[model samples]
Structures are given as structure tokens and as C-alpha cells.
Target: MTATRILLRAIALALLFLPLAGAAAASCGDPATPIARIQGAGDHSPMAGQTVTVEAILSQDSRHQGGFQGFYLQQADHQTDSDPRTSEALFVYTRRSLGEIGDRLRITGTVKEFHGLTELVGIKAMTRCGREPVPAPIVLTLPWPQPPETLENMRVRFEQPLTVIDSHNLGRYGELTLARTDQVNATEYLEPGPSAQLATERQRLQRVVLDDGHRQQQPRPVPWPPGGLTADNTVRAGDRFGQLVGVLDFRFGDWRLQPQATPELLPANPRQPPPARPEQPHLRLVTLNLANYFNGDGDGQGFPTSRGANSQADYEHQHQRLLAALRAPNPDILALTELENDGYGAASSVADLAEALGPSWCVVTTPGADGQDEIRTALLYRSDRVQTSGHAKRLTSGLFRHRGRPPVTQVFRAKNGDTGVRITALHLKSKSCRGATGADQDQQDGQGCYNDRRVRAAEAIVHWLSELPAPDNLAGTLVTGDLNAYAREAPLEVFRSAGFTSMVHQLQPCDARTCPQYTYRYKGARGSLDYALASGSLQPRILTAATWLLNADEPRALAYDGPLDVTSALPWRSSDHNPVITDIRL
Candidate 1:
């Protein structure tokens, strides 16, 4: 007989006795094998390279125009074997043929293991034996009820509420890294090395990403939390939900749940308005990272600049969001990072920002660009509240010139002349690992790369700011901006040793130390990267301080790269870093 005829005859024989799947039976060549037995004992399929028939119900078709080209077949409810440790599901790779969920199908193919996934390929034939009831879902809990290895490809339900610990990829990949509760950044709360190791491991065992099932890039409407993600109704890392039901799938080095439908979430940590005004009539200061504000003359002509908006339209989008965030805190002094290094001319980035902030706001003019960095730190104060008291100074010595955005320090006095405060706006060497070497590379500690450079920059900053002359009537000094180092790192330690009190720790205490309100989220943990540190003279005067949850918690896709996902122009989701707001009597 021909190969096609033999395949057809084999499939015809398998259909005769497949309904008796729980019992041993021989209806096709070499008899039939149980899917659980094929997946027995280890991570690899034991029946690999052998042809066999298995009866299953098609649970989902993961095939589209440009898709996975396969369908998931799971053992029916009535046909499951006695072995509870073995999963009852299998993946059948069929590029040309299609099947629907609930279709009872017996497939005859050669078992194969591709990239750790047990699947059937070289499919000879598939026989539809009519539909049966879908397998009943097994109930489970977060922090995992058991090792998920046995539950691979099986439908499960999570009735326990899961918190949104990390939504970094919600917009990019339609993924949600959820946990039993909001997770903490290890380095933020613990020391860098051995202490962080334990935290990192704990984070790993507790995470499971929820994927949208499609592998395509940039889906217009992100699928999650029942409703599409929006600016006002957005989900953050600390949000929570009551229940989630989906198929547990492992792929690309992570365990993901492909939800049958969108999971409805109860907003545990919802979008918050900007920081409130200080109790008394005092100065409110805000530190923000502009997220690269570059305007290209209202057109897309400028092909490339160092960093920022790609076109004029892109610039407007970035600008509007940034302006909204900057103004939301109702700050008297706005200390900023990541402003374009373009000069203070009419078309300058900082100049345009001042223009949008209304007539009373003014940018403190530097003698020239703050060193040669592509972006510089700046100070913008409301003229109605505070006025520049002295010429701005930039740290040009040591690590500031090469590895960091030079710190910009300017003394500002209240318009009524009650007192003055030295606001030092700093943008430090980033913690990125690109091109790093020696002590700069990841020390394995949770500090990541460039911890050394950031440390040196911090030390230099302390020395430089200490020597500067404080303006007359100055009550205290405040250091604010992106330190680019976490709370437990060497940089903050240097500031601590120099008698600077971290207001973040003061307002929101993590432990004995001041672990400020987190302004940044990375790799599934939330912690502070921006801070407001006050000198001893100013520390006692600080009334209240907090991180305005406008940026870091929001999805990255809401930024200028995509179409305007939000239109209200509020501070929420304006930049990658949340603004640090401090209300001080000084």
C-alpha cells in the first residue's frame, strides 16, 4: 500500500477504540499510547521519535495568519489516567490544517520534543471523533500551589487575588508580571550582594507572566485587566485582581498563562492625583526627569539629535505630557533631569518648557551647557514664589564630567525674602551595563552595572556642593534629581555620611533607614531612583515629601512613541520616572 493509504488506514483503525482512552487498547500501528505516559518521568518526552495515536480534545487553536501554527489538545475529563503527576495535554504541530476548540480529535504523529516542549510533528493524520465536554479547570493559587511542571499546558484557575507587581511589558508585549502582593525591589530594601541574592531568587519563584496569546509585535489595544489599558483607568505595578482563569504555558524561558479571556482586575493600587500642597504656606519643590523633550520646529525635519522626540509631532506629545507632570505638583521650584543640552536660545528645549509653564516660570540660565553631556540637569522656579539668588554652578571636576550629567546647583530665595534654599538638580551616571568594565560591570549584587561610577559621582557631588557658597538668608540645602542609584547603593550612603537626610525615607520609611517612595520600576521590582535629600540645616524644616505616582507606574507605550493613549495632559504616565515632591517651610 502507498504511504498516504497506510496513514489513512492507521487513522481509521485508531478511531475504532479511541473513546476507551483510559483503558489499554490497540486500534492503530504499535497500539495507542497515553499522552501522560509519553510525558512521563522527566522534562523530555519519552516517546520521542516514535509514531503513536492519542485521543484528546482540542482546547485552543494558536494559529492565525502569522502565528504559532499549532493547536493544543488536552485529555478529556472522562479519559484522564490515574497518574495525577502527569499532565494530560499535548501540542500537535499542524501548519496546513486547522481545528477548533472542543473538537474531539485523535492524532497519529511522531512524538517530538522541540525546545523543551513535548509536541507531535510529522503528523500522519488526525481524525475528528465529534465534540465532547472541555476538560474541567483545576483551581490553583498564586505564589503557586505546587511546582508548575506537572500543570504545563493544563487549564487552571486562580481565584486568589493577584497583585500587579510589574506591568513593564503590558504595552510592549501584552504581558503582566503578577504576584501574590506588590513586590519590592531587592536592592532598594536590602544590601547589594548576598542580601540581594536571596531577594532575587524569591522574586523568580513567585512570578508568572500573563501573555495575550498572540506573538505579533505592537498590538494596538493591549489585552489585560478586562478593559483595554487607558490613562485614567490604567493599571499599575501595585494593582490587584480577585480571580484569573487561563492555560498555564511555558515558553521562552518563562512560565506564562494564556488567558481564555481578559481577566477582570480590582484596582488595588489605582492611579493617584499629583502630590498635595503642603499643609502650611511653604515652598513645594518637585524633581522630574523630562524623558527627553526635543521640539523640531513643529515639523519632522530634524533627522537626528542626541536624544528625545523623533519628529515634531513626537516632540509635542512628549512635551505636553512632561509639562502636565511638571505642573501637577504645584511646585515652587521644579528641578529637572534629561532636558536637551541645546542652548538657552528661543528654540531651546528648556526655553520652550518654560514658555508652556506660563509667564511666571523662568529657567535659571547656566553660563553654557552643563559640560558636554547630551542632556543636562536644570532648575525652573515659579517667579511668583521664588527668584534666583545666585549664578548657577555646575560640577565639572572628577566623575561629573565624564560618567554623569554634571550637577546644576542654584540658590533660590522666596519672593517675599523670608528665606532661601539651595536646590541642587543632579542627573547622575546611569546604571546601564552597556560598555561597562571592571567594577562598573554587574557585581552580581542587585546594584547592576556602573555602581562604581555612580558611587564616585556621588562622592564628588557631596564635595562640590559642600564647598559652594549658600545664598544670603538660606535656611537649608536640598539635593534633588535622578541619582540613578537605588536607596541601598554607595551613592546614597555617601550622602548619608555627609549628613544629608533622604526625605523619601522620612516620608515613607522602609525600615530603620529612609527608603523613600519609589520613583522607578525595573525588572519586576519597584524602588526609588529619584530622591530628595536635604542637608542637616534643611532636614528638620521639611514638612512632608512624597513621590508623585505620575510616570513610573504607567505603561511605557503611553509615551510619545505610540499614538496618544491619554489626552487629559495630567501628570500620570508622563515620564519614565515619577516626580519627587517636597513641601518645605524654608
Candidate 2:
């Protein structure tokens, strides 16, 4: 054959072999062969024993079975974005050693068709080419678009690693800091003043000692940092530090690198005392159930007209009386139960009380489930004595099962930053006083059912309390309210069984008639129902416990003597039960 004809034959043969070569390259399961890449979603082609390299983003990283840490990487920009298909073509790596969130990784392994979905088997990390670009380090700044309302727990992220070089105060309002790349040639100093003043002052204070012991006096600030922050503008310290090109986090008001990032430790002062062991502050909590603290009929029964309108007048009187009692006791924390739920109209009641007590007193109230129509529980505290460190949690029992009422609870930190206490206030089922002459039979199953429900509530509360971190330093718990269950009732016993020590039991006994321990009176018999119970852990520091019985001096006839007194039978005068108070040293 001629030379040209032979070349033509060779070219045809080359074209025929090209498709086969591409197919071989696409196949990924040969142990001896390195799989360059694999592409497919469904289960039809390259069924099994095919080694392949799949590209995806690390979606989740968690400990897997067989003592391995597994991570799931998912395919990007797929139709799965719309619905169930979003999770298709997923690869699972059952290896504990893996990258973290937002990592773009490639895995080489054999495909195992398990349950109709393709999964990677014996997967190994691969340094594959053609990956997505990693995001640039995030640059943060002060007066940030969404400046954090509070700096106590703020965090920021960046593209590149950075270190804190210097920190300087900006008056009492805040401070500023300078951060730079570890390999930067020049040093950076954070000083108070306008950028120009700061730049100039930084030169003057070139050799200043930093909190972190390291001397970070730099010749001058970088002429132009990433964010318009130079040495000229009087940027707030927080604003300047926030502008640093790295992850920033606010911990208890001080700006620092995030936990995931490298942390810069300030050098300790040799002259300063070694950090002292923190002591739990002594907290005094008094919980009172001001029973129906209203002059007129709160439920619109219209029997207590002699007192005044149930609107503002009744609330004012009760609020005033409560304030007087609070002043007398002078407790640091007060938990009030059976408060009127009069919506915004009744906001004045709490506000007035807070005002009467002083600027140091702070009050937070949660309206009853029925809005402002029912009785609600409230917490009043001396801001100087205690600071609310966490969110408030409301505790409710099974609907109408317990006392036909729900309760609220809150966790607070001592103002001195020493103690943490969880306080719960309750208003349990009250005794029914409907039909029946002034006889014992008229009491019905009110007390019995009330006792049972309270017992259930106590069991639930105990279970919840058990889950809390046990007290480390100070006694860490207290439960108070108008339990409505007398001291000797089964409900009280249930709480006692759950490690609560009743304060009443801790006090001296007195005559049943005129005892300071009696919190409630029915007909002619007086008893103790309002109580304060401390956790078994706090039994040692319980300094004093007693009942104030604010209305004990008033004649019983004066309270229950009104017209509808026969129908509703509730006292028209102040409250039938008095406030229970206690003091504990932490």
C-alpha cells in the first residue's frame, strides 16, 4: 500500500480507540489504578467494585458507629436543592480523621450499592484538582452593620489567621486593639485618640507593655488596613478590634479570638495577686403568695364593693402593702405568686412596686396563660444584689391536672458574680369553698385533690431539678410558692422525698391558733400552706426561715364579712394567706 493510504488507516484506528480509552479512564475501582474522578447520581452505571473520586462539601461531621468519626459530603448545585433529591449522591466517610465545617474535600474509594444508593467504601482523602474557591477571610468592623447590642458573647470570623498585638483604653466607655499577621514586618499599637493622634501617640508610646506581657510597640499602624481603619480616626476600641481581619469573639465584654482560632494570652503582671478562688455570694430569697391581693372581687363576683374599684384602686392598695412588707423584710430576691393579670393596665402595679423599692429593684412578670385576665406569678429582685444571667423558663404542670394553674421559674446569678440559683414560684390548687354551710363537710375533696396534684407537680419538678448541674460552690436551689398543701400534706412529703427541706419544719413549733408558722386560715382553723423549701444541698447555709403573715393581725370577720362572702367565701380584706420569707447564706 502507498504511504498515504497507510496513514489514513492509522487515523481511523485511532478514532475507534479514543472512546474506549475515555471509558477506561472514567472507571474508578481498580486497586492498582488511581481513579482521577467519578461522576453520576443514580445507581445504573459502574455498579460495584469501581474505584472513584467524588467531589463534595463536608455537610456534617459526627461520631459514627464502630468507634469511627464519620463525615458526610454532598454534591453541590444539584436538582436536590429543591426537594428530597437534595441529599442524593451523598458520600459517607466512616473515618474519624476528617476536616471541619465548610471544607471542600475529595474522596477516593470503591462504590458499594447499598439499599439502592451509591456509597463510598474504604474511602480515603484525595488532593483532587478543580475544587471550588475557598471564601476570603471575613473582615469585621465596629459600628458593624449589625453592631451587637451587647458585647458579652459576640464572635467574628476571618479568612486568614491573625493575632492580637496591642490593646489600649478609650476612656471608660471601651477600649481598642491592634492585630496583625504573624509575619508582618512592622509592629502595631492600639492607643486612644484620633487616627492621626493614635498614630502619633503610638510613636510616643512606642515601647509600652501590653496586658499579655509582650511588648508590642510598633513604628506605626499599617498605612491602610483592610477595613478603612488606619491610625487616624478615633474609632472605638471595640470598633477597631472588630475591624481586624480574623475571627473575633466577645467573652464577658472583652474581645478575643474565637475558640476555633488561635487565642492570644496576655502576659500576667508579676505584682498582681494570683487569681483568687471565686466565692459564691450570699443570696437572700423571699417568696410570697399574696393570696387574692385585691380589694374588690377580682373574678367579677361583685361581693367586695366596700374595698373600691377592682381596676386601679385595688391593685394600688395590694401593691403598696406588698412594697411595705418587702421593705420590712429587705430581702434581696422576692418571688410573688397570685399576682393580678390585668394586661398592660396592671403594668403599673409591678412598675409602682419596682419604683417604690428603688432603682436597684428589677421586676419581670409573665402574664397568665389567659392573658391578663387571670392570676400570674412574678419575680422582683434588687439589681444590685442579683443579676439575671440567663433566660427565664416557665414551668407548667399538666393542664388543670395539678392545681388548675401553671407556675413560672427563673434562673439568676448573684450580683457579686458568685452564686447561681434556680427559683420556682407556684400557686397550686386552692380549696373549693362553693356550697356548704360553715361545716367541715363543705371542704369537699378540694384539699385531697389539691394535695394529689401538687404531689405530681413535685415529682415533675424533682425530675427537672435532677438534670441541672449540681451545685459546685454555693447551695444552688430553692422552690417556693403558695403550694396550697399544708406542711403535713402528701404533696409536701413528696417534695421532702425529693430532697427538699421545708423551712417550717426547721422552725420552732407554736400554738396552732396564734402560731407565726400558720400561712392560711379556713373557717376558724389556721394552718401553714405557703412555704419555702431549699435543696438538700443548701440545708447547711439556711440562716433563717419564717412566715410574715402580713394579714394575721386583721380580724377574720373583717376579711370574709362582705355580702358575696357567702357565695364566693373569699376574704374581702387583703389576702387570706400571708407571705413566706427566708434568708440563706451562700
Q: Which candidate gets the maximum TM-score versus the true structure?
A: 1
- Prediction-by-prediction clash tally: 3, 20
In candidate 1, list every pair of residues with a backbone clash: 504-516, 505-514, 550-573
- Top of the candidates by lDDT: 1
Off by over 4 Å in 2: 1-281, 294-315, 343-348, 365-373, 400-403, 433-449, 468-474, 510-516, 556-574
Model 2 TM-score is: 0.43
Error of 1 at 511 (Å): 6.3
True lDDT of residue 287, candidate 1: 86
- Cα lDDT tens digits for candidate 1, 188-262: 778788878887788878888878887776665777656677665577777776657777877777788877766
**Candidate 1: TM-score?**
0.90
- How does each model score on TM-score? 0.90, 0.43
